[model samples]
Target: MTPEPRSGRPRSSSREVLSEAACELFLEQGYDATSVSDITRRAGVSRSSFFNYFAAKSDVLWSGFDEQVNAAARRLRGGEAVDAALTGIGDGLAPDALALAITNADAMGIAGELDRDRAVRQFRLQRELAARFVRDGMPQLAAEVRAGALAAAVLAAVWAWADRTAAERVLRDLLATTIALA
Candidate 1:
């Protein structure tokens, strides 16, 4: 039988390992030069394992937040209040690969990549939020307006929280402050 890895590490941690490896490689060699194979090699996992967690290379920096955004979308659609649903976006978030990339985009040479990927996520949240508001009896245009502002707030709070030094980070508090904008 193949021996299991030790130290209580779970199969799911492969995602985290791949993200860390990708971030380190991006810093070491820049994003365009660091391929998926490079990340898999550095992370000590197979290419298939890398795909198990991320769809593409740029996904290494966006998956965690994307997961949270999806969770928040589910919560909102399930009749959760807007503030509660939006704030929950930060519930389990920690300083992660995306934060590292944001803070060191210049060194990692991923500024353009960050902007392009982030816009996709921001609008996704906006679309989800707008639908939720419409279900809650908001007029169409007002729902869109409110959702747009709240979506921007959610992204801003996430970005600000990520920008903080890890030692001082508190995501829920930041979420609360930003959610107040809506």
Candidate 2:
């Protein structure tokens, strides 16, 4: 059990603990069954403390996903291809990547209340990718559609693999393919 997150902004350590607790509970009790109270208890924090870090249990489950999205954006700007960037983070970065991400996202012990947030987060990530494509001189409409497709493909692949060696293999393959294209 970890100490509660400070009253102000949530600390990384606390957030990590929350995420771990959420994962454990989600796996043990199933995402649909686990409660915020269960997670807080597992994390050794009070209910209020749990709320301090994450508005809900789902937020705790998907806490680091947004970070991965940002990493993808950075990787794109750094001259690394999309597949290479996905491989660097996990394994596959295409169709397989989306599957892995979905599975991983689902593992976060999400409650019904958090579905809207999850969907919105995904939409926002797609938008980010679309903006990146526009910067690369793609036409606005084409870039938007392509960005959404690319983001969707990557997310789907990630969900399918769900933190497995297959995910790693997919990522490596993507990197290799990207390098070949370059």
Candidate 3:
């Protein structure tokens, strides 16, 4: 007889588990003190499994938001309106790794690193937004300025949403509000 089939979760779930474990460990032991091995152990996965899901421990926290950024890039490339593409990027986003990291940055001893990484992401999005603006006939300097403001507002909206109780989050709406306020 064949062994019973496992009702196992999708392989992708390991990423989530690893992120959760990493965040908990970071909060408990501090970022530098928590190794990839510690996250793997806490996640009940192998080191190889962790590597398969994440290039580095930092990826565990940033991957979700990175995907959103990339998706926005694709939309911009396809010539969607900047406001539509950028604001809608957070639609259907759940409170995932980025949210956890944002809320717990200080507690996890990751405030400095988080800020650095956040700037990288912000600038990356700004570049894409600026390119799209240029494509739509704005001057380079003006495009850069507008993109910088919009990108800052987008990230700020994410921070605001993460800081709030989960029940209060509707990221796209908050994004629209933030962009308008900006």
Q: Report the poorest 10 consecutive residues by lDDT, candidate 1.
A: 4-13
lDDT of 2: 0.61
lDDT of 1 by residue, 48-83 (tens): 888888888999999888989899889888888888
Q: List, residue by residue over 152-171, the lDDT tens digit for candidate 2.
A: 56544444444464434565
- C-alpha positional error of residue 181 in candidate 3 after TM-score superposition, expressed in Å: 2.7
Model 2 ranges off by over 4 Å: 1-12, 74-88, 91-121, 163-182
Q: Could you tell me the lDDT of residue 171 within candidate 2? A: 51
lDDT score of residue 99 within candidate 3: 84
Off by over 4 Å in 1: 1-10
lDDT of each: 0.87, 0.61, 0.87
Ranking by TM-score: 1, 3, 2
Q: Residues 47-101, candidate 3, lDDT per residue (tens digit)?
A: 9988888888888898888888898899999988888888887876789877887
Query: Could you tell me which residue pairs clash in candidate 3?
Result: none
